[model samples]
Target: MSTPGEKPDTRELVEADVVPRSRWRMQLVWLVPIVALLVGGWLATKAVLERGEKITISFKTGEGLEAGKTKLKFKDVDIGVVEAVTLSTDRKHVVAKAEVVRDVANLLVDNTRFWVVRPRISGGTVSGLGTLLSGSYIDVDVGNAVKPRTDFVGLEVPPVFASDIPGREFTLKSAGLGSLDVGSPVFFRRLQVGQIASYQLDPDGKGVTLKVFVNAPYDRFVKGDTRFWHASGVDMAFDTNGLRVETQSIVSIIIGGVAFESPADSIEQVAAAANAQFELYATRADAMKQHDRIVDKYVVNFIDSVRGLTVGAPVDFRGVVIGEVTQIYTRFDPEHRRFSIPVEIQIYPERFTSRYQTGRAGGRISDDPKGIANYLVENGFRFQLRSGNPLTGQLYLAMDYFPDAPKAKIDWSRSPPELPAVPRTLQSLQDSVTRLLTKLNNIPFEAIGNDARTTLRTTNSMLSKLDADVIPRAHDTLASAQTALDSANSALQPESSLQQTTEETLRELARTSAALRTLADYLSQHPEALVRGKSGGQP
Candidate 1:
């Protein structure tokens, strides 16, 4: 320091004390760098915290999906965005990568549904129209499952009902899936109260099973004895009541639907539980038929033709259906060497008779089917076939009293207990015609014609005799009678005995001659009167 220039000798003498700065303190220039480092670190941490969960959804096709434009929505609210769309390794599906808000991470469960919401029409429903204007989006239906899932298979078709809808699910087993499909309406009293949720063929492939949802208040109407039927198209039926056309609504007719009703007697029954199973009948009449517990089977052998009578033909008692034909077959009798049609019918006694009789002790036709059957059979109760519909030529079996029918007895030992059956009306008419023809055939017409000819010849001979001999004689007698009348006129005198006698004699002779002429004329005209006595009339 002393070796510096003379100017430095003056500056250097003032030896400034260099202070040691604290390690924790920073210089003003270092403050800017430190703040920048802290700011950068905070920004990195915030980026990590806001990031959401990543999910991948697989779809059959990516029709409306976009990498960055499509958004994920639940209940019409945006919850995520699609990041990318790519084909699967197998190229059979379109895989979409998405980032959903962390709040919904737990909701991504196994049953959670994902589908592209686009304008669509299915099962007579128009949906996703709003998505058309807003662009297509990924719709989600959160499931009620606890199992978490990140990978999902998207539905090509959207669900008919959301999981949050207020309803109860039920199952129906049908021999076939008529016109029903997802979104098909279900009606109660012609009011739409539910829809078909889904359907699938049964495991055995013999039938189809449908899952239906009935919303809140209408669900309460389903009872233990509730019946369901196919109410899709116009249900037309022809029975004793004549033509009946039944339908639920125009919407149902178009898309197809189901209808249900609880029997009046089942109103007091408990409501059916969720997922309750029921049998779907083909028609309302079949579904509403009262279930019979007591059935008695009897066979009827008919010698007449059984045309127009089918197995399902109704067995009627006084205009009421009490049974049905179950089987019809030809039976050969070994001893009689003839074929007879045997008809098996199942009768429900409860349809006609009360369990307990009223008014009198023996009025009830119950508790003893065999005895009652025997009693009825002995007292003119008979079965007859009658035309049910003249237009269709359908015949049904009828049971009624026929007091004038010939006596018949039932052989109780016979299997199925044969019930006496009379011929149908047409068959009876045919029998009567055949009997009349047979009687006409037995008449001796040729012999009667010969006898009539013989009688005619005899009468002709008598008339010829009268015309040839008696007529001329009657003319001569009439001439004599005229001469006698002239002579009597000449001999007549007042109170002379000879004159009086001659006048009386002439009067008697004139009467005899007139009688002879009248007899001759009668025999000439009425020739047949000679063979038999004349009737009380002029010839």
Candidate 2:
């Protein structure tokens, strides 16, 4: 230090004033920490403000949930991660906690649906199979509602993507639940364009209600008169037309399905509104039966027994079913003084027309029963019970023109027009058989048996008498006659003496006759003398 001070001695002597040169430096050191603190605060604030919103979803199962591993995807684009997996309070479901990026926050809504994506095979569809190897994941479907939401109830099954698709919802009512299931295809003219969304049984247990979805282009096929039928499984039928096997599709055959068709004229009509209620027919035959309309109600009284008749039996015209029996009852007729079975039937005039009476869809027959009855009776129209199923003894009402049958009188003064009936052909045959059986029962079987027994005994006695004496006596008589004939032949031979004597006796008889004739002539001359002994030696 002393050596360096030679130059510094003068410099230090000048600065020896000890001017307290600001013990604090340029203050940049303090500024450094302040800037760092401010920057840290700003970074912290940014982190806090930019954080994504947290969401909770309830799922029936946590099958695909993995803490920090399960990613939520929208259309295969990852948008969130499952942060926590826990059970609901009731333990009926799993609650998955997730953080969704702010970028997609608008997608959350009240109606938004979520489901686990895994390998599935249903209704001829194989979905999410790639997830088998990649592992399962949560799939998110955004809703269109403007209201934002964070809590969600997950779906047990994947929902149809209605946002990207245009379609409609419709309701179907059915009397029975057939092969149709959720995801079962709905067909339009054999083209699959929809599916069954849900089903519910009526509270009364009389029918099943189904909710179905139809895609855009195919939904236009549904109309006011459209017919929906269960096309699932195989349809086998044998009829006058012959055996028929009907199926909508191979998928339908495997998984079950529904099909719909509109009337030809309805093709140009307006499409049914969303959630339009329609009937689901059990079979195509039932759908085509067009049983919706009612035109006439009539009472047909049968003269013969209605043993095989039942409600819902077809009332046919010729071979075509035009109506059905609705009710059967019997009430004593105060005027006619008899209790008769009243078969109440409903007839559809549209059934007789070549095409359905869609123009008359809401129309009904005139209420003038007297006029209608008179017209029908004048036209020789009659109702009769006919055997529909011979093996089952099922009978149905048949309306036909029986020109030669006795005229049927209709009593139109009654509440429901009464239609007189002719005996069924089968009933007539049964009556004939009954009469024959009655006659057979009345036959004198005991008297016939007694007579037959007496005849048999007499015949047996005669046979015994013949065997004991008649045959032997007859044989002896025949032998004696043969012996006498042999003796006569021997006596009358050409060279025998009896033959020569017979010739001489014949000549003597001729001579005696001649002498008797001459004596009779002489006796006639002397009347009294020849009264006795006219011929010689005659007296």
Candidate 3:
């Protein structure tokens, strides 16, 4: 310490040795702080190097999410944690910041999927039950894509399948979603083969496109010609073939599902490529029907009632279905003041060709369909509306030979060439009755009745005269006959007087004969007395 006024010792102090202050000496007090600072810096560097990827996930809502508490998991293994949760600039979504472990940082790719795990039910599935006890976490699905991404959109629902599951995804286009939803099961031959991965409405809003995954060996059965249909609820049909009930399973009945199968006749069993697009039919019958490439349209005009006919009604040729009714409309002829029913039918010519094996190969009908039709019409081929279901009053168009049908000409100039039509059998019978009644109505019934009444009166008068004149004469004749019979009976009696008189006369004659015999004997004795013998004998 230098005194305030003592300057005389300064010359002697530096003369003994010239000493230099150490350039880099750390003070003891600062030693602890330096060491601590070094350690803190090392830790910060290590954290920067060993820390997982920092990612932000956008969610619709902050439901089932928490900052610093919710973990990020892959296959139920903790790989990261949610560090912060904040709202987006537009306030439309909740953005979660997460730190993934360095070990799995490579898995944060553009295709990696993230979703909040929560207890929920969808499409007949109960998932995330463990989350109820353990709290919600961010679920991650690792992606194979090499492109790294930090910003992501979280899914609202769990994925239908895991990335590691061996399967092929397919796209199905349908008129509507029906009962199908994400996670809805997909069936192959009623076997649970896959589930619906996702669905989106078509751009034009005309239909929906669904993505489905068929697992492993079942995926091998997905052929190019495989048909898909909605197998939801019960498929009950009552038709010409009779009642048919079809279903996949009880699960399908409750939550709806999709089913696929190749036609039994199909030979193309090659596995379909991934994401193959296919049409989704409403029912199995529709899906299984053979596609017809050849179509022929015609119009049939009927003068009779088409009460039970409808669109899609079968157009039958004999017992075979050749076509279907497309449309039915009424036409009025102003000049004739008459109405006619015109039915538009779409015929599958290939159906006829294939069934009958006609014309040429490859199911080709005759080159001249018009000429053939005209010839058939000339040969009495006509269309008639016939009842298909009596109870339901459903009608179908029948094409058959009607040799007795009235001759008619086909007007080929119409948009759809007109085909000849005959009245249904019932209608024809009604017409016959109407004509018979008309003929009976023409008879002169009043004149006939008057003539018959006059004849009856004349006959009755004649009969009355006969009865009054003939009855008295007939009774008198009968009485006379009876009297004659009584007189004859009395004459035959033994006690009558005439009978006694006759007996006495006969006795006198007998006495005279005896006297004559005695006189003859005396005459024999005396010849002279012969003449007077009889007198003497008498005397």
Candidate 4:
């Protein structure tokens, strides 16, 4: 600096001659930091935007869901986050805006179901408490395979995986539907395999129809011959023993379910229509269908025929239960203009096949002609009334095979086969007692009382006459004979006639006593004389 300013050295003029050239270097140093800040801001913005995909999901309710703080998980891994929440136009549901990771977008599919996962009230499956720390969001169950993007259906409760896929349009008409709730499991062979999808009243409002969905493997087991029944809660029962209902677990008190059992042999044919309807019956309709052709079209009256029967009551052939009474109801028969009770029953004809003899040795009646002749000649089928609960006088049907009985003349038109009458069990015994009392009541009590009185009077009179007349005379006669015997005994006394003989006998006895005493004295004095006298002479 001093050399360049040599011209100014003469005056040492203010040394502020020229600003340093290093000013530009100092400005460059500050500019580098500003450029770096700008690049960093742009990078951060791009990273945030690239992390996820935008998605909108709608829900009926969002009680357990939260926006901004909620996360969406797939296979337990965080895949997305809830960005915003707003109500729909109708204010019926909450619309949730979510940002899912781009990689997981393909997981959304038509079959994918969305529902709120939270703790259950009763002792069942519970979840979503982890959301308290992480947050609450829809759990995405991306199936094992990749799926197409679509709107997923939402469920009020967690959707269960069924073994069989249920038809969307299929419906089940049941007696009681309001009693059942969603998520109630349907059982096949006592194993849970499906659930109730929804329920509603029929268009006529007479009954309810339940929409049920069965899952994969289980649906395969449901064939055309499968039977369904209400397998939930307490089924009402009223009988001679009074009202009785059976209940299982306490949990069943609040929830109900349905069950099905497949027939051992079923038709392999599938329904022609995509959606097929099946009608369930409490009893076998085969026999009834056959009977319908023969019987006149009279209204069926359940009260007249089977009102007395209860659950588990047997519908039998010859004292054996070929079936059982299942349900009973009263309905109007429009043709007859009268009310009638319809009884529903379930029959297992196969149960009676073995009981009927099928061989030449005396087989039961068979539908086959070749077997029919032998059956007619050898055996016959009949139904008999049997007591199930003796104390309650509950009766059931029993079937029996009789080979020795005559063949019954059956009327194909309007004729029910006569049932065999069974001997009294405890229930019949009570009935017998009742009948006996009724018979006794028919007797004329006044006439019986008069006859009894007359008979008693005659007996008393006969006894009195015997005591007063014949008995007294016989006693008098016996007294007279006894007096005569006493007199005869007194006259035959021995003392009067034998007195002299007695005196002579006493004298002899005294002399003999004296001689014996004298002999005893002599022997004591002369023992040697007593011994020699035995050979010599008589003393």
> Which number leads on TM-score?
3
Model 2 stretches with alpha carbons more than 4 Å out: 1-39, 89-92, 202-205, 237-244, 265-268, 301-312, 327-343, 350-367, 378-380, 387-395, 403-408, 411-418, 436-539
RMSD (CA, angstroms), candidate 3: 13.8
Give me candidate 2's TM-score against the actual structure.
0.70
Candidate order, TM-score descending = 3, 1, 2, 4
Cα RMSD to the true fold for all candidates: 13.3, 12.2, 13.8, 15.1
Candidate 3's TM-score: 0.80
Q: What are the lDDT scores of the predictions, listed in order?
A: 0.88, 0.83, 0.89, 0.58
- Over 133-250, each residue of candidate 3 has an lDDT whose tens digit, in order, gives 9999999998889999999999998899888889899999999999988999999888999999999999999999999999998999999999999999999976545468999999
Ranking of models by lDDT: 3, 1, 2, 4
Q: RMSD in Å for candidate 4, one decimal?
A: 15.1
What digit string (tens of lDDT, one per residue) describes model 4 on residues 107-155? 6655655666665532133456776665456777555345565444456
Q: Give residue 129's error in model 2 in angstroms.
A: 2.9
Q: Candidate 1 at 135: error in angstroms?
A: 3.2
Candidate 4: 10-residue stretch with minimal lDDT: 290-299
Select the stronger candidate by TM-score from 1 and 4: 1
Tens-digit lDDT string for candidate 2 (1-539): 56754654454554435566787566766888899999999999998887788999998888878989998999899999999999989999999999988889889987888888988876567789988888888888887898999999988778754556789999999998788777899998889899988888999999999999999888887887899999988988543234669999898889999999876545448889999999998778768766555567888886567887888788888888888899987768799787778899998865655654444334434445457668878788999887776666778889888898776677767777878788888678889999999999999999999999999999999999999999999999999999999999999899999999999999999999999998788776767664554556645
Against the true structure, what is each candidate's TM-score?
0.78, 0.70, 0.80, 0.52
Question: Deviation in angstroms for 430 in model 2?
Answer: 3.4
Model 1: lDDT equals 0.88
Best by lDDT: 3
